[model samples]
Target: MMHHLGKVALPVYFWLFVTWLFLPLFVMAAMGFRDSNFVAFPIQSWTTDWYQSVLDDREILASLWVSLQVAVLSTILGLGIGTPMAFMVARFHGVWRAILITIIVMPAFIPIVVSAIALRMFIGNFGIQTGLVAIAFGHAVSSVPFVVVMLLTRLNSMSPNLADAARDLGADEFIIFFRVVLPYLSPALFGAFMFCMLLSFEDFTRSFFLGSFDPTFPVLLFARLRFGFDPGLAAISTLVLVATIALGIYAERFTRKRTAPAKQGRLAASGDDKNV
Candidate 1:
């Protein structure tokens, strides 16, 4: 009786928690469509004017362009640095490897605000005015740790025998890595890229500190929100939410497609050996 009750309670609690988390998002989305200049709960009438207004806002567009440049550059740079570090950490076993991984991931555990402040002070001393380059550098620093951790986890779970098999087949080190390890790491790489992109997009504290001459999207959004409530802000937020959801779905599909063949190949190999 107790076991059955516990099983029933688990799903009920899960649904409740899910609802709790998404309720506010739903509310905000609805408010975005409200036919009013100011954001108000329990929207009076539905209209798309706010979204149109946001689309026409020049400052918002410029901020979005700045954000896109930063996010893309930062994610690319993080992947370049993080992928090799992840491979090393996953493939090698040594005291130095562990120490290196620890050092690489240490920045992630630090408070974002603290890291931002430190970056601000450092950049200030160099007389580097805050702008696109500063934002990209700050975002890359913050996101690399996440990419390394995610890729390392994926690499560790992969079978080392793949590399060994390639070597046994007379493949050189570079060829074996490119043919074997690269395919295996594809899903994790895509996931890390998406994560880094999102981190760069939604970052507020780091952008606030590192941004001076031009602001990123989030920084601009914050500045707009400080003056007064705008329904257009809600519209922008909703658009961002929808974009994030779409990207998440796309990433899932990409990962599944990349990994499915590897899993099926393993199964087929086991079946062949059994038949033999």
Candidate 2:
């Protein structure tokens, strides 16, 4: 009896949680279709004019362009920095490894507002003005910790024998890294690439503190919200949200597709070894 109740309760709980997570998104999507200027409940009519109008909003378009630039710059910087950090971390062990991890991931624990302010001050000390470069740097700083963690996780699961096998073939360290280690890390790198871009794109505090005349998408949205908003804002947000979701789905599938071939090769190699 208890088992049956537990089974029923689990499905109910899952559905409830899913609804809680996605209901707001559905409502927001619906809000975009609202015919009225002001956002409200019980839409008396529906229209797509708001969505059409957003395409003509120069300010919004500019902000989106700024956001795309920041995302690309931050992802590159994050991967460039974090990939080496992950390799370095993988070389350490015991207390030293723990200490290194703590220091590297310290930024993730810091409050965003505090970190943003600190970054702002730090950059100002070097006479770096708040703008695209500054915002991208800030985003990179935040993304590095997560990048290190993700890459390290993938690195840890890798068998050292692969590197050893390459070394036995007389490959130099750099050749082994590029040919063996890098290809092995492709899935993790791709995932990190997407993650860093998303982190930078969605970031508000860092962009706000680091921005100058040009603002990121989130910062611009916040500014617009202060005056008032129309269905057009919701329309734009829904479109962005849809795009983000689609990108995430694509990344996930791409990563899986990449890793599958590697996994199958590893399994086949293992089976041959066992047979021998």
- Write the residue-wise lDDT of candidate 1 on 1-276 in tens digits: 889778998889999999999998888888889997777667778999998889998998899888999999889888998888787777567988788878988888889899988888888888887877788889989888888888887676566577788899999999987888877788889988998898898888888988876888889888888898777888888898899889978987987787678666655534433322
Q: C-alpha displacement of 263 in model 1, angstroms? A: 3.2
**Candidate 1's C-alpha lDDT?**
0.84
Q: Tell me how many residue pairs clash in candidate 1.
A: 0
Model number with the top lDDT:
2
TM-score of each: 0.87, 0.93
lDDT of 1 at 227: 96
Candidate 1: misplaced stretches above 4 Å?
124-127, 159-161, 164-170, 264-276
